[model samples]
Target: MDKITYDGIRNFIIENELTDSVAISLHPDSFDELVMDYLDINNNQIERPFEILGIEILQDSTGSVQKNKVNILNVV
Candidate 1:
């Protein structure tokens, strides 16, 4: 998985014309995952346009989860 730099994320948001309401809804960690996945699909090394299919939260019912798992779906 590639790492999404702060600048890369900023550029993506700007290009997409994402409003504050939409941007604020995204989890901070999910942003990186979303960016990297988008890059892979487009075969690009930098930020570009993409659409979010959905955002999912995968949690452990065992009550031992140290961190939450978030899946950012970009395609069906």
Candidate 2:
């Protein structure tokens, strides 16, 4: 799996024009865990965003499930 760092993730969202795309991870996987882990490792802390949008992650097939591969749908 690719190492998605804080800057990498922030850049990815910016590049994708997803200022509102982040907030929460839809899936209960290591991606979110990794983010938290990274933050913990880096000793970084962040407050919740104005709108911490929730998501519904659609898991993929192949019997090889991953959190980062989740297809996120905004929570209405």
* lDDT values for all models: 0.41, 0.43
Model 1 Cα lDDT, one tens digit per residue, 15-68: 656543342223445455646666776686642233332222222344332222
Every model: Cα RMSD to truth = 11.9, 5.8
**lDDT per residue as tens, model 2, 1-76:** 2653455545555565554443434234545654575567567763443122222223234445555543333543
Please give the RMSD of candidate 2 to the true structure: 5.8
TM-score of 2: 0.43
Q: Which portions of model 2 show Cα errors greater than 4 Å?
A: 21-29, 36-44, 48-70
CA error at residue 33 for candidate 2, angstroms: 4.9
Superposed Cα deviation of residue 39, candidate 2 (Å): 2.1
lDDT of 2 at 35: 52
Backbone clashes in each candidate structure, one number apiece? 0, 0
**TM-score per candidate, chains pooled:** 0.30, 0.43
CA shift of 38, model 2, Å:
4.3
| Candidate topping lDDT | 2
- What is the lDDT for 4 in model 2? 38
